[model samples]
Target: MSVNNVRNIYCVGWNYRLHAQELGNTVPESPIIFTKPTHALVEMTGQEIPFPADQGSLHYEAELVLVIGKAYRPGIRVDELVDRMALGLDMTLRDKQNEVKKQGRPWLSCKGFLRSALITKTLPFPGIDNLGKTEFVLQKNNQEVQRGNASLMVFAPQTLVDYIGSRYGLDAGDLIFTGTPVGVGPVNHGDHLALYWGEKQLGECTVQLG
Candidate 1:
């Protein structure tokens, strides 16, 4: 399914222990939730992604994205919520994000910009029992930069769905970005970024700066 069909793009932060430590953050006991509006949706169509002209230090966060096919109430099970899976990029304006954080403010500006959410085409869901075997790898400029597995996630997909649902019931078209792994770094003009599930290339996009 197309990301355009999604209503809300939910995101979890610091969900990977090593990633949290890499950024000098303490691991949270519960999930740190945030969101991106639908307007931020961007398809990984092998085109150049125009960088936001006003910002610098655009960072790439490779994540596992879950596509919800069934409407889930507070008590819904994980198996009933996920319809498919895909690799996604949670693009961030890092400099702006830090500035806002220093001032103790909400920083949607760093995350919720046009074409900020880049995703691959959805593939059939790997059942919860097999999630531990799922893995993600990211390449920038043709070099491997990040790698992670679902087994390393502090809050597994099931727990994330349950926690998010108890507070806010999810609709059939909701999308969840399950957070990034370590080695997230900046991308510059003319750089290429690619995401993969094992050796299978899922999506790739170029960075365009003006």
Candidate 2:
């Protein structure tokens, strides 16, 4: 799938129970959907990444991403429409997000900055049955910082696709970020960030604060 041809970028929030609790938030009964523009996308190719330094507390959110291969149809299963899957980073400006949350404002400013969405190479999706047994991890400077699987998600892939598709609608070329787990932390300059799907290392890159 060509990332450049992506149409919409949908992201789920508070999908993991542990992630919600870690942030002192309650587990939401349903998925919380958000969006990012196409400009936020950046492919992870072992390059030096430059981040906006003025944004306070730049956070790295490692997530499983779904690549929608078919057009939307109500009541469709995620696995039916998603042709591939990948590991991704949904970068956030934590302090700015907190400030907006206090005011009950949209999170676009904090979540939709240029190059905020980072993705790895797309892999043909193993069946959902097989996927349930797999997990993804993120390491900061060679130290494991986050680990998560489908079992701990508050809203699973099925629920997310159904909700977002039925309510807002999804289409071909859309990407859904299935949310992150606990152990989310700020990214700093010179940090070596590595992402993995099970034992398979996806990619790695170094961070540089702009």
Candidate 3:
């Protein structure tokens, strides 16, 4: 019963150059998407992630959540499209994403929060265009900081669904957190975040403060 309408939420900032030098930004060439509102997707563990006390840091970007099942745009390629894969949680706010890039604004307060993109439950791959060499991971309370694969994504994942459907148009429960690697930081208050792809742990949460 999960995997319902999640509308747009394609995020892929600094695909991973140590998260673009921790935020300084560089290696781009393509996908650098951003967006997160569909009610900020709350509770999606088995269900229940209501943590938000005010916000100061709260970071953790262990993503691999591409779940689109239809609807396309932007010169559709990669053998058309159709998805159903899993794992989510792209929560961030590192000081409101460093004051929205110092000032250039727009990132909706470090990625529209509330429950901040937390999903899973739609697992039916053979689609998602294979996701070029998948193999991701990121743990906290357990150890293992961050691991990478997806061929060190520098804008892959079908080029971020064809450059974000050629400018926002990917429908059918849109979602695509395909980023994160090079150990990101922050995640206090109870911290227990966990995620995996190759070994298939897919979900885990506990960070409470907001």
Per-residue lDDT tens digits for candidate 2, residues 1-210, read 677899999999988888999898999977899999999998898999888999799999999999988877877776788999999999999999999999999999999998899999899988777887888999999999999897788887888888888888888899999999999999999999989999998878888998
lDDT string for model 3 (99-201, tens) is 7787888987777876777765556655444555567677788998877766677776777787787677787777777888777787778777767777777
- lDDT of predicted model 3: 0.71
Instruction: For candidate 2, list the clashing residue pairs, or say none.
Output: none
Which 10-residue window in model 2 sums to the lowest lDDT? 71-80
Candidate 1 global CA lDDT score: 0.88
> Which candidate has the top score in TM-score?
2
> What are the per-model C-alpha RMSD values against the true structure?
1.1, 1.0, 15.2
Model 2 clashes, total count: 0
TM-score of each model, in listed order: 0.96, 0.97, 0.32
Q: Please rank every candidate by lDDT, starting with the best.
A: 2, 1, 3
lDDT of 1 by residue, 1-210 (tens): 876678989999999999999888899999999999898988887889887857868899999998888887776777778979888999999999888889988869998888889998788888888876868899998999999898889999889998887787787889999999999999888999988898889889999977
Which candidate, 1 or 3, would have the higher TM-score against the true structure?
1
